[model samples]
Target: MPTVSDFVIRRIREWGVSRVFGFPGDGIGEFDGALGKAQRDEDGLDYVRPTHEEICALMATAHAKFTGEVGVCIATSSPGGFHMLNGLYDAKMDNQPVVAIVGQQGLNALGTSNQQASHLERTFSDVAVYVQTVLSPEQAQAVVDTAFRTARIKLGPAVIILPHDVQGMEFSPLTPENWVSRSSAVAPSTAICPPEDDIKRAASIINAGKKVTFLVGHGANGATDEVLEAAKKAGAGIITALRGKQVVPADVPFHSQQLGLLGSLPSYNQMKDCDTLVMLGTNYPYGQFLPKSGQARAIQVDLKPEQMGLRYPTELNLWGDVKTTLDALIPHLEAKTDLAWQDKVANEMVEWENEMEAQATLTFDDGVNPRRVFFELNKRLPATAIVTADAGTTADWYGHHIRLQRGMLGDLSGRLATMLAAMPYATSAKFAHSERPVICTIGDGAFQMLGMNELITVKKYMKQWQNPQLIIVVLHNNDLEQVSWEMRTEDANPVWSTSQDVESIDYAGWAELLGFTGIRVRTDDEVPAAWDRAFATQGVTLIDAYTSRNVPPLPPHITLEFAENTGEALLKHDPHTVEVIKDTAKAVVTEGVERVKGKLHIGDDDKRES
Candidate 1:
């Protein structure tokens, strides 16, 4: 005899899930009860409590992104369920193996309606691989199997909606047959590599180019090593999307700077100069930064065939999982270029870095030294340390800085930049490894946008992390960092942040109050010391480094929806930005439609947008 809760928990363990990142509530009683008993059991796993459910999902997204395993997160009904949506959208957008478990009020309580009652399943259906509600123990087991399958086959995040009453209910001895998921039911292949000729043709282009450049994206995470080697053979330069930056080592000579809005100015400048531009593992959409097909040969290799040439036109298209294609291409390619090319790209990369830090407005000349903090921490951190960044200007900065050491960043992913995604994503990243130190780089303004509270998961799930510590170094540029700068550059009044009462709500104090080892870092020296204490002393730590919020507005900066002054009379904001964003978005959307017409990435995803 077993219970739905037992089956779900057991299923979680079977999938190698040792840590679960989430926030629970009164609505999830029976499920939580099972969680308690399981934890008490000899084999029970860890429930990772995050500062917020949204953070939990994003954390789960990162954990999944890096490991290719199903990253799991949980949250309660109503707003909590809604809270997880933002990060799930990120996971789905980036195709990470993420699974979100949501607690429900009661199946019977539907519309007959209890407090906090809301449409949880309907809310998440489109964003998830599959959205389901459990009714019986049989359905519970089925959902568990579905959860595993959804994560693996769908290639994105999935939501398993659980009814509280069914969680711990007594059930008859269920045979193992129903528990083992059928592979066909979970994962269905949606795309394929181009024909044999396509691969050879692309490989030929790679072997021919004297100066080849790679614009790597999130899709290219695990294949960095292979891509680097290929670059070595071609004497090429490799650049990555901000999210994909960590995959390549900072010290790699061929590792180039990133491209797009908020990327290195030099790389953006190099777009027109390269002889051949290669797009790998990334579906970077900014056309302004992409290489021009007429000027440079553009080649694309991606996991999905349709991904090639969606934004930038491609001269040669090769479709295969990055690792697989690299294996095949290495044998096909001949040594074409010399080490001098990688050296030149590497030099340009260094110059770009110096210029970035020098001109950056985000530096703490007043008192805080963000550049120093990031540089020093990056130096001391094991090339292996995983960094989760919240979307804001800091993401752009972190994008510009913080390259991982060799092989350490093989698992990290996600570039659909959004804020507060870092807190929980790091919470999940650290939790996934438990002992692995996961650091979150975020801005104070961005943190206020979401899950600034899931820190409790630190104390609640202490036993899971051998150290159970999360080190969050907040780059607090007191002004509405991006907006204020936008105003200054354009000569308009900055809409300074009303995000939080910063004086009243000191984040370091909140971390301290939450049983964390909070350290306020007002100067540069304290940044490393705080990190040392955080790593050595244990528990969670918050290093509040008050930085200047003068960083450049990350490009693709919002299409100003409202009246915003841009120097001359407060005329309607720049229409060009909106038009570019719309055009970029449409190119992607149009590509999808064309693919659906030709049977591309859509599978059994039944959620209808129309």
Candidate 2:
């Protein structure tokens, strides 16, 4: 008879899992041995071992995001399971389907306070939708099936705690005499359309408003055409949440990129001015950026009923798949001939783009402006590229500068877990789509935390990819830039240099030591060339971009509070006060100049026409 571990592996394979991310330990030795045997077969699961258990979980989350498949990760019990919490939370918060299989101390060791014998089910309760342990070999298949099914249906993580001794036991098939249950590997359909009455009510509100805005999120991924069509019919301006960036093409005339601190000015203006608001698929967390509570008549459509009206007071809530709901609602919407609102939004977006370009080109006294690095990378990004960014100024530039084309895919830790997911996400994206180029943008603080170790994992599997283009862009600023800025803007506090400053490392040298191409960029002029060279390289390349810590990532709409707090912080005599003030002034002045230039150009066009 086969071992229970072998049966569990076979069950996961039957569920269509082609790859599994994991790390080996004695707690999971049986499963590891079974995996080794499985690897010898002609059609077997590809096992990817990242540097740590945390990375395994992060990679699993990325796999789900990129491939739209159920991501599976395995780890030893106790300490290994503890390390996976952060990454599992990443999946949970982002609403990705991931299954974590963790090993435990033997059943005989229970209640003895033995090694690695903690209550895993209780530990994983908050992070996972479902958590269970296989008490017997006969129950193994049912447990595995339920975990995968629950993960898929809940759109979150599921945990399976396998005891060490249970894995080596002989597998038993389900039968009438054994009191065992059988489960299927088939996945259920998720597409749902809202009721006709709800659809009509949503349509009526959208139709009656003179100025309308659509807030699109990740739920709108596959319904791009429907969203565009509905927007055209409703004559609405489109604003995407950060997670919904790829749902609609950035170049759409009526679309104003993203909305929030890392968002565009046009998006802010559209939200503030629109009389009607329709939110789709996204539960955007920033309530301050949204229209005031009674200012606009709101309608929200989401797959989860609980998510409906959670962000704003909606006149109507439709719980349905975004694409199906939109398809059903679109026919009821009367076509609007007045597209003046869309035209105004498009024009503001043009101005916003001009301001961003001006900001990107500004020179800094200390080092290369980080915006310039991302600005240059955006120009060179291929349509087939998959990009991942860490939480920091990297996310700032990525949100404001990078305009992902229709076919391209990009994501980060949506809930913004700093220094935890970027490199692992990129590694997993490369593994999932070996034919596409992958780019990871990370700050020095985050890169040093875990990214360096993941490079070894990259090197070990570099030859397995058909397309060997994985570019890691390191913004080598010797400070925790985002935290520093947040203190200034949110707390009116000066930079606490002792805690904020990061130890400098020769990042490019380390990459070169690992036998990968490494390029160092110091000046503004070198930014474009460094990106060019990284893209041109046939294998993994790391661009160590020495960037300024002083460049402020200005919010789209700067309020009195932000201005006052920044001024107070500056008055407190921060170490980089002079540089910060200078950089901030330059960015502000550049935007003013760009706005004036745009007006003058328009005036000139009017004069010629007259």
Candidate 3:
């Protein structure tokens, strides 16, 4: 006679909970007992122990996202579970499949104001796709099963809490007797196609409009090519949400590379003028960017209905698989659209191309811009290699600089854009994709945010398998360059950077502590040899370069517009560095304004040409 904890463990496994993240504590006492018991009873139910709760959930989220499987994360009581909420939010926003388990106080103690028994459902309501609290052991299976179905089928984050007392009680089975042998849950109909009328209306509206635009989001990930097909057929321009950027390549003429925050101007302006906005698979967050008056009819297509009208006004909401929805809509559309509108939009996209080239061209003089870094990295690395980056400036740099020439390979991190996930996530991605070389890039400040202890994981994997997938390059600037720039240029106090000091940790020494091969490059002259040694390492290797902190990135277009001052900004150096600060002063005072005056513009006469 086993307890509900036994069934819970079984259910977790059946849901393909291959990995569990978070700490063990008293709140999950019965859970701990059940896990220990399962180890004795079952042959291979090994639980993974992560150093931090946040790392654990992040690991689980990455594993699930990369493998297209249910990522399971577990935490005990309120505190540990709360630590996982950020990663849970990332999973939800990224549309990754995630199932969370939190330990609760016993049922009787729940209402007694027990120490660890808290209102977790209310806490997670807004962040998760689905959430439930089970009162009985009998209900645990159903609750877990439903959560699993929601996570796998909806491909969204879901949560379930098991009270300690329920874990110790046995009940009738909710799943089939041979649960482990069941097939995996497929994406539910709700995630793909919602209703019939909305679908027809969405199609009809697109059929009527002369100029159609497709706005993609995370929800529309799997159907990128199909959406492209519909765009090409309708002679429509494609615009992507921040989440959808990686789904569609920036190089495509029809694709709108204009995303929010640090995104470009073309897609944003194009959005303002379109006659029809065809939402393909995305639940874009910034409704403000969408037309305010419904002048541009919005034809929404997604797997989830709840997501529709969440951000903007929707004239036609079609619920179906993005791939299927496009197929359904294309038949109703004319075989070809009037190229007059499409070509006008295409010509506007030429601005994006000129901007891209301006952004990509790097001078030997400019020390390091994220865009330039990505440009250089692209040439050195193979096309199909994997990349993992922390949030913050690294995310911004990558978002602006890196072009997603491949498939659904994208990002992670909560909306706050917090940093320091690359190393840990790279460990998971490297293990998952052993055949692919995994690149983890982190800013100096970001590398210091997480436990330096986890570098051991990379060492362990390399020692055991002689794996070459892990390649971590720390963007070693002395301070948080992005924040420092924001403070100086944008007039905001620089957010506190996590960097230890101007001359921080002996990064090479830290790498050696964990059995990783480490190299430090003191000058730009050492770049080639340092990179060579890194590739020759037997285990996880770290390349720590001393970079110029004041070298602000000057994109071609931006630099061209502010030519004189651009050169001045590029020359500005951190006081401690050996860069040419005097040269910047001369350029700024002499003719910076005149250089800016020479630039070109059209449409508006407010000032310098755009």
Q: How many steric clashes does model 3 contain?
A: 12
The candidate with the higher lDDT, 1 or 3, is 1
Clashes of 1: 13
lDDT of 2 by residue, 296-397 (tens): 999998876777888889999988889999999999999999999999999988888988998999999999999999899999989899989999888899
Q: How accurate is candidate 1 locally (lDDT)?
A: 0.67
Residue 60 in candidate 2, Cα distance off native in Å? 0.5
Worst 10 residues of 1 by lDDT: 601-610
lDDT of 2 at 478: 97
Ranking by lDDT: 2, 1, 3
lDDT of 1 by residue, 189-305 (tens): 534455778778878887777778877776766676788788778777777777677667778766765776566544654564578888877777678667665778888887656
lDDT of 3 at 265: 50
RMSD of each: 10.5, 3.7, 5.7
Better of 1 and 2 by lDDT: 2
What are the Cα lDDT values of the candidates? 0.67, 0.90, 0.65
Residue 477 error, candidate 3, Å: 2.3
What is the C-alpha lDDT profile of model 3 across 1-610, one tens digit per residue?
7687777777677665655655687777788777877888773245665666777677778887667677877788888889888778777766778888888887778667879778988988998878987777656766777888888667678888877777778766456554232333333544355456665676677778877777877566667677777777777877776556667765686565645544555565566668888777776666656775767887777666687767767786776778766666666666564777666656656655445444444332434434445555554555556677676566656655555665425554634455666766776676566666667878878777673656765554553333564667777766776666554344423224443244578887798777677787665556657656655554577877666564443322232324444334434533322343443332233223332343322324223533
Clashing pairs in 2: none
